[model samples]
Target chain A: MRGGTAVSIAYQTLRLSDLPGLRAAIRSGDYVKHTAGLGAGHLQTNLAILPEAYALDFMRYCQRNPKPCPLVGVSDTGDPMMRTLGRDIDIRTDVPAYNIYLDGKLADSVTDITDIWRDDMVAFALGCSFTFERALEEAGVPQWHIDHDTTVPMFRSNIETVPAGPFGGKMVVSMRMIAPERIDEVREISRRFPLAHGAPVHIGDPEGLGIADLSRPDWGDPAEIEPGKTPVFWACGVTPQVAIERAGVPLCITHKPGHMLVTDISETAEVPVLNPKHH
Target chain B: MRGGTAVSIAYQTLRLSDLPGLRAAIRSGDYVKHTAGLGAGHLQTNLAILPEAYALDFMRYCQRNPKPCPLVGVSDTGDPMMRTLGRDIDIRTDVPAYNIYLDGKLADSVTDITDIWRDDMVAFALGCSFTFERALEEAGVPQWHIDHDTTVPMFRSNIETVPAGPFGGKMVVSMRMIAPERIDEVREISRRFPLAHGAPVHIGDPEGLGIADLSRPDWGDPAEIEPGKTPVFWACGVTPQVAIERAGVPLCITHKPGHMLVTDISETAEVPVLNPKHH
Candidate 1:
């Protein structure tokens, strides 16, 4: 299984443009691994599934804190199909892995959730930072964490998200070290992808976000701040997980940390500008 | 009363920056008039109130159809205080007038909704075109409707808004005639206010939107399309009103056509960018 996972990861990296094929591999359980660089030009989303009772308040929380939770697609109540996101994506089995939470505590991880599917479940697909990370890589901006083949370091920041019902907690952010010269270019490029956590929440001074040490992080790997490099922070998708823990709902489901749901929508697809003439 | 209303309208035109004083006048029934140019640099919003049972669906509708319904602020259930919009905005009495809709039919127009405020009701304040209109006026583009002291002509368009649940209908657009050369500048200026209906949905042909005659509009008085001036259309705030009517909810409340809720936020107030460094 380990060798099979490694081979599948290599294959996925080579066929970055084949979204449907990649999704198929993920759905079939043949490629059960992180989807960091799988769908290069396509949008990858963080998943959150909650019962209909908690759906409204959670939606409000996303609305209030859009930077951390840019919602790309939402499924109808009790519906497993995400029609707006892809041609035939099933929420229950599309992702490589899903983390099942019982009363906000991790109960188990599973490849398929069909057994736990409920009549009142609502799935939310949120934009992930990988979309903008690809954009940055395309524009020649180097990412230290990616180069080192390690997960991006994430930290819980001092900044508090606007409270909506039980979904309120300090925001979580991911750090990337970049040369000072490329900071402006990176900011400009990222701002275009507002749906994917556009722009840096902080460019320098980790202490500003209440982080005492650059070497210590709440999640993922520790990044080295090389000479002439500055630390840049962006709102992380893990934020919803933090909120979910605080909410302590009876049952909640989410994609594993780095494992994501790949959608058919292009990362560069201009946020739908409704032009009557074109229609 | 007619003379007093006229005097208050003129008074409001002069005291554009005084939002609180203006709201006081509106609350007192001293200014029962259109709020086109009332709050010059401040943001004016279109109001919609719905029962909690229908709130989630209505919010989903707005999320799916953001062009016509860019939500600026949402109130907690049964809470009339719009804390985010202004210092002391009471949803019940801040607007100059309210339109009561009972089962999709116009029941009556009232000056205050204090008597009808429900514990299960939720209020939503949506971005109005007035914010971008002020930007256009500031940028030296003449709005013929405002110049003539008349309402902007609104029409029902062929463009169907992306629906959610029971809320589904064709979009409503407000038309403004612009000189051919200034069309580019107007588009650029208006694009800055994405929250305020963003850019024109149609630039030249009224027939494209299914409007056969410019002189006959579904709502508001007609404006003459001056020679060499092309007709430009923008998504109107009234699109939600049409959806509310189509949904046929038992009871709904909205600001009477041109009567809006004046908020204290500046028109140019940069959309809150979550920067941890700044905090």
Candidate 2:
């Protein structure tokens, strides 16, 4: 809200404390726009819902490749209620947008999936890069995409994700232009949020990850690398989406890019440290 | 060898560097005993093998309850090899002892499982308490069970585990007597090994976890608490065993209580810090 150019769609000037109200609006179909600054300071997530047949493999896929798919919450089979993520959070209609895929191809994008929700389906919410992006911004790091009103540039890389079942493909990475001097500071800050794709996978050369052309990204608009700025890459949530496509599951549902599931968990909630002495 | 009374069975003096040789000796049936001090500085694991029918649920079960079941390695379905754990490791023959369970009942204890190895079976190696115990010992913490040449006392606690499919039961914990003054130091040291059950789940009162008597443990011999000592409880690997029992799977195989699967991974190996700066 402070730095980025606002989108054309009208959104209420909401504060971090107004998350429940915002979510209610999203559920009522009153707000179908991308959720960026609406629920500021709260954790927003990427959504992936699959059938029971594919649930185990996809869960394993996430476990093996945590950098790309840091699982924040998983719903029980056939249960639309994601109690672990938030109160009254129904997977069938919580998100603003959902992309339904059939046989590895996108069939339709819908605002509500209550009609198509299946008893054999399971929903998984993954930590989105937005969590760390917010952290970086709060720490005074500049984000070029937010400065201009554009999506962050993302590209496919040569790094192959650890395969699980039918899910295996080259990792997808989101690129950000940062001054070389701030690399270490950014790394340290980002490393603390393991659920939000912890740290940058590649800091310097895009070519090192087999990325030939920076201007031509696989997804999102390309951002120019200003002089003295280095292109830093982080494992993207899209990596799992691509893997899901490759797996060719009969039916899959995901959040439309930029449309996320906002949760009650605060972005600054202390990552659960295992301490027996206190318990 | 230094603190505990030695077992009567003669074991050739083996050093940290003698892991491969010791594992080979164990595989050849030359050694069949507790693996606490053997292969020092290396990771030792508790094994759990289940049929594919229950594999997904069990994996999910472990994921939900990480403290009791810190998964270190999971083999592909029908595969006898654990490629990630160690070189030339065969799940069928590597371990010195295996407990075969039939429908929640102990069926038999065997030296080798090659005869019962099934194409539908999946092998999982969970991080054992031994890894952090080694860390504690290295940090000058005294383990009374090890000092007395007895197994650490284990008890079933009243705390229920987060259920996954058919796997849900009260958590199992192993008790250790520590000086009240050294509790903080021990907690700090053990917390570093997340893969090794990390820190204690409970610190002082045994009855807080519904444990009535410290001297009357459900399993393993009990150690007398010395003056100025407090009981510390860690989530035990035996947790999964109890859950599996409650699950009542048709066929499940696990490692014999103390006999573990020794891996090539060093106990002090940096627990895979996800640093994208290098890659």
Candidate 3:
């Protein structure tokens, strides 16, 4: 909404507070831009849709490694509606846009996946760092990426996720520059949002997590590190995308990067790891 | 070890602090008694092992309904070793006794399940009430059944669990008589250990949970209600067993009632819903 090009369809001007209106817009192919700054207080999820065959192991991968893939909700096998996440939330057309992954590689990007929706597929909703970033802003500790107007820088770390089926790989982490004095406050507030990757897995040293450079992140745009601040990392939702890509399932679908599915759930609602800590 | 005869065999005087010795005693059929006070501060677990065919649904069932099925650990799809739970913990011989369920009914009870263990089976260790009951005792709220020297009273509640695949049913609750003034403290402490069926689902009236009479529990022995004390119910680990029984999986294995698999995990180590809130 802030920087991306918004291609509005046949609809009135959409307000940020209107959840149903926003979803309806997304469903109707009205707003296909990134879901940043929209539905400000509500939960925004990183989406993953896969065949039922891979769901069990994939879920095991999630349960074993929660910080990266804090599963918020899982749709019933072959079911399009995610009754658990919110009201009338259809997984197929609810997101702003979809990324079609064929054998774990990006094949096509589309507005809606209604044409490719299959009976054997299951959808997973994971907690996004945006929830905690909002919490941070409310708490008066603004994040680096938001201030710089860039995507949260992500990297593949030396930390290996607990393997389950074919979906195990190095954990992908998002970097944030935290002032030395405010690190504890950030950790305490973040601890309250485990669904939002909880507290940082690694703080201070990037080499401890085996990343060679801070400016060259594996994914997302790299940001500057202020003189007194240290780089902090949280397990990223993109970790699962990395794993999914490595797993190479015949058919997998996800929200195009930055494009997310916003839900009716409030940010303070615990997303309920109270899991999106093992859902 | 106290009331139920601990048939101590060839092993020389086993100390309660020794985990491997205890497991060895159980594995060798030396100590085949109910594991109530055996491990003391160490973690005890309720178990369910199903072929990989049903593992995903069962795990999802655990994820959806965490209180009743607080998943402490899950083994790899075909692995007998619960490396995630503890060091060198083998599911086949660790539990004191195993209850084999076939087509939703009790088929056999055995001291060892090595012969029936399948290559495709997955074992799930759930936090037993003993973990929280130990916590409660430390908090100075002695439970009625423990004080009275009887099994915890259990009943089927009208509250249905969140269904996942073939594993949905009414929640089974275990009741403990708490003094009216201490309910809040009990609830807080219970919340801290979400792994051990955190917090009570119902309090005071038995009818609220569709429990007909406190004197007649559906499972386990009924303990007398202390006058002026309130009846509080916690979601029981037995809930999953009920679901498993109803689901009628071709091959299912669980710990015999009262007999549990004791692990090396400490009671205070969080089990770690920080899960047993979502995991």
Candidate 4:
């Protein structure tokens, strides 16, 4: 992990919060990189665009699985403007990368999706760990993957998500290594952002989560546990993708893993993860 | 406010925690009264059953207007059972009475909806003031109308709810006369049940809420202020009814104004009213 990469990502995050300016870069194809460490104080979301036919069921699925799918904003059918998420935000161009799906299979990875935007499409934005990951960085906790310019270590967990309509799958989790002394501080900061997956689902012992090895991850890089540090896991946004693929809708699109939409909503915004029955 | 009504209502509430016994009484033709004080500690929800076509937009409407529409449970399309709300809960016969709407007009009022149930209908449960009003009672605060056996005074306010598709209308508020000394305690208690309209939207003024006189309310009975009491208002669940009526779908069904469904969920349950942007 390099010290300079963290500083560079930090600079982009701080500067881009002048959101319009940052979005211009992404919109104009001047900045095409993954939005891993960008967009600091504002909420960053995992995007999913589904047909109107599948929208209602998917919403129920999200409500049932708030830990992995903390919904931040939903767009009206056929509407490209995510007005609730940000001022003058166009869902088709705001996100840097998109995974286009045809009949539930990934067909293409593109920078801009305006060409394929349809009249019956509905876009939904779910909260990503990017918000809380920045919180950890601000609170003096180290992020191994961000510094290394690598993806966070994510794993497929044994826990099953509550099924809705045609969506159901096992949960996916992201792991971070935290020193024992800083564990309390990390938990305190993270739990406050319920939209950002809240507290750790598992603090230590990967085997308990049914992961056979820390070295082998289902997705992303393997984050090694430093001496005296425990492995902490948070529900990952990828869990929804798994359900979507299994549901196999004819046309579905999502942010290519690691790329996210930077929402105008701030981290301090007080939306709690809703009770399942209350959702 | 009377002495014996409060005592009798309290007695039914306590005896009903034996839920099966309570529901059996409601399920059969035996108990057909309003559910106001009957389910003290459990979650009591305002019910709305909509055709599948209108379900998505109505959901967005609820998500957009959390103070007035704190969504508690959503039934799967065409499903009569609200699996998430309570065990063995059948929507058709559970609520004491239902308002049947055809083309936005009240067509009929009935105790059970099974005879009219269809394959493309969805039922949604929104948190009602019944839960928080019970809290006010438990906290030693006085509810003028409840104690007097009258409907809580509700008024239409000038605040416009964020509109979704065909659902957009002004918010409705419920007013209560609170002794100035207990105002803080009432606010503190109500805010904790975000699912229960959170805190008061206005305190100590009727004119400011655009009411010409507190003596006349738009819905429910008028609550008069006692010598040292102040008028406190919370956003009412009826706000959604206004939107639903304006949308005027071909078929819409809701619980009768004062009648509600007593859910298996408890009042102490921790569902927060979501941030509008984050919903």
Candidate 5:
């Protein structure tokens, strides 16, 4: 939004107060659309709901691979309320869109998942990259997705995540082109959001992560690499979803890509530990 | 151990490999005493086993006050195997000694807790101070405890820990007297072991943490401060036990102080961030 680029899509204008009402609108079977620019300045989350049996392993998986699965909040067993992430956030009815996966296959896409909600289900809210992406823009980094009116390019990488039970798969990463001189600035800014995918994993070549070409990504649109810029890769939140799919669980529910669950917590709750004191 | 003065205890007489054999001896009801200096270069942990209902609150407490209660490993409900801490750790009988607490009272002391283990209980292993103490000795910061054949002096400080649920109390700290010149070296060495109370919370004076007299410690034997030495305090692991005692839980079990669970993980495993490049 800071860059002087021509606007293509009708950008949804929203205020800080619009969040709870927008969530309410989504809860009552209204406003079932992509939540890209809606509810500005509030933290949005990637959702993963599974049975209590898989909860421990999934939690360990997230702990082992924090960059891709930075956990924001965990729900108590058989409870839908996520107290840490938001106030009165019902996981069953909060998100604008939900995707149901059955035995590693997409079963259906729906607006509300309350009818199929079970007692043993537990929801995990993971921090998404959008929070840090906004931080990057504020710090004066040029993002191609904002300028081109397309989703950020994400690719399936060959970097395997640490295994915990059935949850083990190659990490997926999203790429953004940044000016070479701004590389340190970008790293310093993004590393603050450990809840989001903190810092760039790879700096230069896409082939380092086993990608054959930059034009063809596993998800999202192709990114334009500008002159005097380098491609910076960040561990994407999609990696956990991909791992969940690979686990072949009976039923797994997640938010539809780009249609995130808006939370009441601020994006800047805890100050970043740059050269972390470690205590 | 590498200092000028002669000591009652012979330093470096123990080897790292002796830990497993010692633990085996303890499991078979043989080495039923304090575990100090038994395992040379390995990590030892303080134990806290509680019911499933209280696990979440305690976890939040540890998350809030990581300096005092740095969680090394956590066990699943009804599971005794602490897979993350070591290769073969059965939480019920690993430690040489155990103290059973019932509703804020000391119910009994035992060698093994397997007979009293319940199906709904969880075990947590918190990092102990021994790791940093070893690092301090290696960095040439002499401690009075090893020289005098006694435990490090501990005190209940007025510094209150961040509260979570029912777990809220003033932090307890362990004091070690070091030469004023070596204080920076002590901080540099101890900061590496974040799990083990990482850097000194207060250095140079006991009165800063609200202790009126240095010679009168709340716990452990007080030692004489040599000329030009200052009293340094590190957040003690005993603070969590104090909180648990005050919480008045129906049943709780903890390691008798100095009788910790010796882990196979090396002292260097205390590093929080293992860069993927190194992995």
Candidate 6:
């Protein structure tokens, strides 16, 4: 039980009580690793930390293009604690890994962003496909990537996102191979989770979204498309990261691909990231 | 045209092409009046401006209590131009009127905020009930407001809004008298405009939402519950103003009641205020 088997046991038996300790361990120098299946049933999010100057436009970008960037939590300017997401979650160090970008370029990767944290910085937590992936598995929808032990294939599309100030770029989509019979099930299940890239954007023909070949993806490993199966594409969270890169902002930070911040919010509940009910 | 009645004609016959001129007229001090039917069929929005320090919380406040504050536009911090709603519209002067609040108290009313504008201020445009009121009229649901030419009846409800940061207060509701047969028709019509305080929150029984009597209201005019008519209550845009008053923020600004910023967006065809199709 050294590799995949160990991961299975660690994830299958994971409980809510074990999350705090696990997150604390990650925050320290102990468990710096990918958070793929660590806390099942809890929501995991893609992180983007940017200067206050870019916050409003980025928010507008999200508001205008919610499918790719369904905002889940927004931290106060200069504040790191995402009080709405979890208790005592220090964004600067809680994530398993951080990807540092300088002038819209990937400059370095690190386990913590404590030294880089600034008072003018604001953080955004966006819903990731992981939430819906979990749902797909529960609903008995077969995913070729998980079956073949590869990452979900993603492609850059020609679809231009509604521009907001300096943030504008083509939408990026992730592809999954599903059987013909299970397509409706996937659609039904995904629509219920709007926070998670809800529903498939396209059902078939990779060329429809400008994908030349499913085997050659711009990002992530390509999965097999079995006979009688159709490829489903969903709006990917990476679209913003790409836009951020193209904008050439002076400084930005995001969660490293596959390394996410697991939140205490239950994946099954319709929890509001902003909690506007009492206002 | 002596009072609002005489002025109503100037707006009722006004065409969409005149919006830019109307906004310009307001900006140049030539017009200091309420914006009602000036841009007929176009959307009019309630405005709220806050400093960056309180923006994230207030954004959450609006997100949580969307019915009252169905966010139509949010300006980037320090930028007064509302890029999404209108290209030429400037937040500083486009609105016909503004009420300034200091420490939760009314400070002054102004026609333009240009003199007091700050680089860190953020502007928010919330959907006004005017759009849905128009829809109800089109659906043949007679509104006491349009018939009597009075402000719709508004009440402070027993329902407490979900609190976010320092913003939390009782929910406010606007009531309209609808014929019994038109209740569902009104609901169907209003439901189409989520940004316009979508549908009725309460259909009847004023006591259910903590109202003592129909004749008395926390804000706006009293109502006459005509025979075979039921009082339909919708979430009022006044909720945020109530919350702002309770929060006691150092400063806040809201559209003077009934005055709004009319936009190029049409009342019927504009995408759902928070619709994913456009976002």
**Top-lDDT structure, candidate number:** 1
Interface RMSD of each: 3.5, 4.7, 7.5, 9.7, 6.6, 5.2
Question: For candidate 2, lDDT tens digit of each residue in A1-279?
Answer: 532234322543532237877788788876676887657577889999999999877987887677788877788888898765676789888898999999999999999999999999999999999888888988899998877767899999989787778999999999999998899999888876767887898888889999999999999987887888999999899999999999999999999988899887778653221122223
lDDT of each: 0.83, 0.82, 0.81, 0.80, 0.79, 0.79
lDDT of candidate 1 vs native? Answer: 0.83
**Which residue pairs in candidate 1 collide?**
none
Question: Candidate 6 lDDT, tens digit per residue, A1-279?
Answer: 012454455544433236886687678846666666566478899999999888877877877676788777788779999877886789999998999999999999999999999999989999899889888887878777776656788999867787777998999999988888889999878866766877777789888777888888999986776788888889899999998999998999999988888887788754544332321
- Complex DockQ per candidate: 0.29, 0.27, 0.26, 0.24, 0.13, 0.15
Positional deviation of B261 in candidate 3, in angstroms? 2.6
The TM-score of candidate 2 is 0.87
Q: For chain B alone, what TM-score does every candidate structure achieve against the true structure?
A: 0.92, 0.93, 0.92, 0.90, 0.91, 0.92
Scored against the true structure, residue B270 in model 2 reaches a CA lDDT of 40
Better of 4 and 5 by DockQ: 4
Candidate 2 lDDT, tens digit per residue, B1-279? 532234333653532237877777777776667787777677899999999889878877776677788777777788898766676788888887999999998999998899999999989899998888877888888888887878899999987877788998988999999988899998878776767887788899888999999999999988887778999999899999999999999999999999999887788654322223343
Candidate 5 docks with a DockQ of: 0.13
Candidate 6 lDDT for residue B192: 64
**lDDT at residue B181 of model 1 (Cα atoms):** 94
lDDT of 3 by residue, B1-279 (tens): 234243344234754347777888887877766888777578888999998888878887887777888877788878898866677788999888999999989999999999999889999989889878887888888777777668999998887887887998999999998898999999878866767887777778888878888899999998888898999989899999999988989889999998998887787763232212122
TM-score to native of every candidate shown: 0.89, 0.87, 0.89, 0.85, 0.67, 0.71
List the candidate 3 regions with Cα displacement exceeding 4 Å. A1-12, A266-279, B1-12, B37-41, B268-279
lDDT of 5 by residue, B90-190 (tens): 88888889999999778999999999999988888899998888877777667888777687889999888766568889899999888888888888788
Q: Chain A of model 3, TM-score against the native?
A: 0.93
Models sorted by lDDT, best on top? 1, 2, 3, 4, 6, 5
B35 in model 6: Cα distance from truth in Å?
6.8
Task: Provide the clashing-pair count of each candidate structure.
Answer: 0, 2, 5, 0, 0, 10
Best of the two (1, 2) by TM-score = 1
| Each model's Cα RMSD | 3.9, 3.8, 4.1, 5.2, 6.8, 6.0
Give the fraction of reference interface contacts each candidate recovers.
0.05, 0.14, 0.12, 0.19, 0.00, 0.05
